[model samples]
Every structure is written in C-alpha cells, then in structure tokens.
Target: MLGAKRETVSRIISQFKKAGIIVHENGNLVVLKMDDLKEKAQ
Candidate 1:
C-alpha cells in the first residue's frame, strides 16, 4: 500500500511484527496493537 518495493515492504512488516504490533494469521494480516504502532510512529 505504500508503493514500496517488495523487499522494503517485507522489511517494514518484519519490524512491525518484531514490535508486537501486527501479525499473520490464516493468510491474512492482522493489527493486534494499534496503540504501540501509533506510539512508535510518533
């Protein structure tokens, strides 16, 4: 969605996953911790 390269997107997703914000389940992407994501963004 960010129009980033496939590798770049993967790297970002990996970071978010490591941060305990997003998850992969049943072949879908789930946001489990929005507050932490927001805190990191800020």
Candidate 2:
C-alpha cells in the first residue's frame, strides 16, 4: 500500500503500536490517537 514494501509497512505499523497510536485487536487496527497521528502525517 502507498507503494511501500510489505516489510517497511509492517515496521511502521509496529512503531505506531508502540507509540500508543494504534492497537491491533481481532485482526483490526484501532487508532487510539487520530488527531495526533493526523498532525504527524501532515
């Protein structure tokens, strides 16, 4: 997705999880801090 390699995407997601930005449950990714992440994205 977004032209990123599979492993690279996985690592980024892992960082998000560790940073309290997201959580994985029941195979779903839940964003814990959308505004924070959104601002970071920009």
Candidate 3:
C-alpha cells in the first residue's frame, strides 16, 4: 500500500473522480480508462 496520508489520498481520489480518470468500487480505486487518463496527463 502507498504510505501516503489519508487526507492526501482522499483528495487525490476525489480529484481523479471529478476528472473522469478513476472510479471507486468496493473500497478500491479503479482506473476507468488508462488511455484517457494518460491523454489528460499530457
């Protein structure tokens, strides 16, 4: 597991969700579409 702060991880997950980059399911973070996420990153 990543040794990041809970608040930091929560913020990151929220941001990613809002950006359509990821989804939360069953207490897990899933990458919805890697290609789209990668495109947005660049």
Candidate 4:
C-alpha cells in the first residue's frame, strides 16, 4: 500500500502507463523504461 488514496494511485499509474514508463501485465506492474522512470523521480 502506498498510503495514498486509491484514486490518486490509480491516476499516477495511468500517467506512467501513458508515458510508456510502465505497464500493467497480467495483474502485475512492469517497468518498461527504467531510466525514464528514474528521471521522472528526479
């Protein structure tokens, strides 16, 4: 649990998915672009 509201988490996940930085596959989250993800973290 991220400790945030479910809606907030879902929104962020959607953003990441749209950005092609992550994906939801078979009920699991997969990071498609690790470098991009790290960049976003900064």
lDDT of 4 at 6: 60
Determine which window of 10 residues in candidate 2 has minimal summed lDDT: 26-35
Measured on C-alpha atoms, candidate 3 has an lDDT of: 0.57
Write the residue-wise lDDT of candidate 2 on 1-41 in tens digits.
33546687668778878997776762353333433555666
Candidate that would win on lDDT: 2
- Candidate 1 per-residue lDDT, tens place, 1-42, comes to 434466765687788778877756612533334335545756
lDDT by residue (1-42, candidate 4, tens digit) is 324466766677788788977756623533334335556666
Estimate the TM-score of every prediction.
0.51, 0.52, 0.47, 0.50
Per residue, candidate 3 scores C-alpha lDDT tens digits across 9-30 of 5687688788976755623434
Give per-residue lDDT, candidate 2, residue 4. 48
Give lDDT for model 1.
0.57
Task: Give the winner by TM-score: 1 or 3.
Answer: 1
The candidate maximizing TM-score is 2
> How does model 4 fare in lDDT?
0.58
**C-alpha lDDT score of every prediction, in listed order:** 0.57, 0.59, 0.57, 0.58
Mark the regions of model 3 whose C-alpha exceeds 4 Å error after superposition. 1-3, 24-27, 31-42
Candidate 1: pairs in clash: none
